[model samples]
Target: MKINANEIKVGMLIEYKDDLWEILKTQHVKPGKGGAFCQVEMKSINKNTKLNERFRSNDSIEKASIENIEFNYLYDDEINYYFINQKNFEQVEVKKDIIGEKGKLLKENLNVDLIFHEDKAIGIELPNQVQFKIKSTDVALKGQTVSSSYKPAILENDIKIQVPPFIESGDEILVDTRTIEYIKKV
Candidate 1:
């Protein structure tokens, strides 16, 4: 469907120059001497490429049609990650690069969305927040308050993030997968 350029948002897939692109970031600029425009940063879905473009509010852009399917995480063997279709039970192997750093959060039996374009998996979306056990962290100092500061900690998956001083080893906490930040104790 066609939509105004100003309507575009981060994470929306659109077709540009006959190729599918995923919006990575967008900024609306209103120049003091010129017309307002939206500055967009997009990544190519078919290849490793990036594009930056500017568009006025009056410009219209094509939104790419994509298929989203639920897949259950199975396991990975260092090279490729495996997933099973939740609907048909068919197994699919995806490259490690496509999963990116989010692969570290993948656990057995976790359900995630696999984005497909033209029957090919282009990307995977992990749960917004994941529960992980704190592998290790330093104990809170005597005078530290929860609101005052954050301490670096490692998770069971080996991903390091800042956590409240009160957090310690073996504590299960909710983490925002996209930002890799601590949410709260769980």
Candidate 2:
């Protein structure tokens, strides 16, 4: 679908210069002396290259028509992650690089939205929040009571994150998958 540059948003996929690109960031600028333009930084999904481009506000760009399919986490073999469609019992495998750090959060039976373009899996969208147990954390000192202070802690998956000073080891907490930060105690 063709969309005005003004409609572009971060995380959107678009086709430009014969390559699929993922929008990393966008900024709409209305300078005092010139017409408005949308500044965008996009990374090529096919070539893994990045480009910074600006478009006139009225310009149209081809937005990639993508599909999101729900799949349950099956397992990984260090190189790829496997998922299954519960309804059809169909299995699909996606490369580990495409998932990057988020691959560590996958758990058995966890549901995810797999992004596909041209019938090929391109990426995944994990739940915004997931439950994790704090594997370890530094003991909070009673005298150093800073309200905004956070302590570094490790989760059961071995990913480290900062949490409230009061959080302790073995406590279950909700974590934001997008930012990989602590949300609240569960």
| Number of clashing residue pairs, candidate 1 | 0
Candidate 2: where are CA atoms >4 Å away? 30-35
What's the TM-score of every candidate structure?
Answer: 0.85, 0.90
Q: Which stretches of candidate 1 lie over 4 Å from their true place?
A: 27-37, 56-59
lDDT per residue for candidate 1 within 119-169, as digits (tens), equals 888889999988999999988889876685999999998998999988999
- Model 1 global lDDT (CA atoms, 0 to 1): 0.91
lDDT of 2: 0.94
Residue pairs whose backbone atoms clash in candidate 1: none
Query: 38-82 in candidate 2: lDDT tens per residue?
Result: 999999997889999999999999999999999999999968999
Candidate 1 TM-score versus the reference: 0.85
